[model samples]
Target: MVNWSLKAIDYEVYNGVTVGDLILVFAILFIAFLIAKIIAMSLRRSLADKMKKGEIEALVKFVYAVVMLTAIVTVTPILGLNLTGLLVAGGIAGIAIGFASQKVVSNLLSGLFLIAERPVKIGDQIIVGNVAGFVEDMKIMSTIIRTYDGLYVRIPNETLFTSNITNPAANSARRFDYTINVRYMDDAEKAIRIIKNVIEEHPFALKIPPPRVFVDSLGESGMSIVVNIWAPSSEWTDVKMDLLWKIKIELERNGIQIPTKRNLA
Candidate 1:
């Protein structure tokens, strides 16, 4: 029984490829995978602050693939495969497959371009096509987005490349407008002055572009006052929410009220 087991362990599988060769192939592959994982972990730690999460992941995946492919090619000889002939055959097959999968090629090229161009980065809130969300990851073939409502969306690179992308975070500053209505009986000039003071009090509101407050239109219920305020894009949402209520409160304190239809009647 021991002799038979020893013979089975040392037997040649095919083409002079023994059981030892198979074991060596697996060992090399395991080593390659371990090395790849170690390198990826090291890179993530080194580039955490220097690069975005999506970029780091993309780079790590690329490195891992290259390492595994190299190991595979190197171990092919253990299985009695020829590298030179395989490369030549692979080149011809790649060309034929490339022609057949034009869209796949296009997506791959688009992904490369996006990584290089960096029109939109990971964590950027963007609206591409009909989807509006924060970019979760930028992959080689597609992009992942986490929507405002917390749904994950995958967009193909080809579609992203061809579509219009609106990245509000790209700008240092952004403008938001509010159409505030005041009672027609209230002094329009006084309301304007009060609104300006409120904007000036807010730290996020930009003073360079200046705040614009003026009577836009006279409606049946009240006078429509246009309020255009500029704030840093990063804080625009908070500024919009915080300053708007303040404006209303300040106006009310100054004896300027938002007239209702009942009051007009």
Candidate 2:
């Protein structure tokens, strides 16, 4: 509706930037931003299946920042600024800032590496440092973990990179173990057989690798019956909880006395 087109009005009221040049620069900057956005969208589409949504979004933002910064730096000369002087000053400033924020730069670089390597992704349950929970999102500076206690935790990217990250869900299946202590007087062989039967009947426990039921250790308190079984990673927690209860109940029915206290006498 309004006249948005510029008609070569030099209109040099200011010393450096004329009205026409300013308008032209604005137009170019807008066009450059639009192009950068397009490129970002394209990248997101291409990498959708290869990475998590949060990581992809982070990558797109990084691309947008780079493209826009390059565009602005490239177009500034067209708007009558001293090109050589600005570049030299920018270089010096960049170097000084780099020195000042080396740690920050390190974290940002580590974040990029994480996004590419994908040790853990959004919705993955992991324990890193003191934080243990499902990863909420990952950014250039830090990673957000939604803890099991319903708290949000943020860890720096550099620390995340260096720390040992235990991802319980990294594999398709996971193994769980339980040590059941029985009184020394109980039939150890019978207890082992009862535990093995319980494991064999568990609906979620995998059968390919087979379950293990063996006498793990003979402590002063009693004999420790070790039970190890594997199940789908998604059901690992539930399987352990329910399977332990079933094993205990089944052992008790078979007269295998699981020691509740140390018989020191």
Candidate 3:
């Protein structure tokens, strides 16, 4: 009558792994997993506004791996299993695998540095190592890019880290230049005024750093007039195309010759 049922529940299984021990082990492991998840979620919440999606994902994965490894090591001995041989075997295997995939490891490390350094971000228009595209996704080993023509490219992180990266979207404004050729007889000063007027008429071009048009060089066929304008980077392409069209139309309306040898000389 002295809690016989409880006594029966305390039966041993094998090699110090009793019924109670099994229950305790499960509880410990369950708590460990839950704690790991909680910590991962907390880190996500805390860094949500600070880091990119890729960085957060990597950090969460790293945290979970460390937590689970610690829990496995702590509970292994309690389960009455000898890990002496297993540890030795695992160490040797790990070393072998590490050496075999050294380049993969290098890419992984480079990806981490890419995240930390943040030379480019998702959706940024960039040119890296002869590839030009908007970043689609940043992964641990490689980066995905969507080219202007819609081709998808995957660049290894090692290449991305080592190569030169050009981010045109990083700055607020960009410059576009056009070398306009005209007959030597065409009034250079008048042509300059016409180009400046067209630039001013267009709203996208920056005004504070006024556009300039001048004779850059003198050639046998014509005068090499140079036009330089700065516009907001976001509208760079549109403005560039529009300005070229406008300049050509004005030059033609004023009967300015582009001085082709066939037409002028």
Number of the top-ranking candidate, with lDDT as the measure:
1
User: Best to worst by TM-score, what's the order?
Assistant: 3, 2, 1
Candidate 2: segments with Cα more than 4 A from true spot: 1-42, 47-104, 260-265
Each prediction's Cα lDDT score?
0.88, 0.84, 0.86
Poorest 10 consecutive residues by lDDT, candidate 2: 1-10
**Candidate maximizing TM-score:** 3
lDDT of 2: 0.84
Compose the digit string of candidate 1's lDDT tens values, residues 1-265: 9998778768999999988789899999999999999999997897676467887898788779989999999999889998887668799887888787788768867886887688998888899988998999887788999998999999999999999999998998999999999887889999999999999989899998988999999987789999999999888889999999999899888888888767666
How many collisions between residues are there in candidate 1? 0
Model 2 lDDT per residue over 14-122, tens place: 6766777777788878988999889888878776775678867877887788778887887777676677876687998888887878887688788878877989988
In order of appearance, the predictions have TM-scores of: 0.64, 0.67, 0.72
Better TM-score candidate (1, 2): 2
| Candidate 3 structure, TM-score to reference | 0.72
Please state the error at residue 111 of candidate 3 in Å. 3.4
Q: What value of lDDT does candidate 3 attain over all alpha carbons?
A: 0.86
CA RMSD for every model?
9.9, 7.5, 6.0
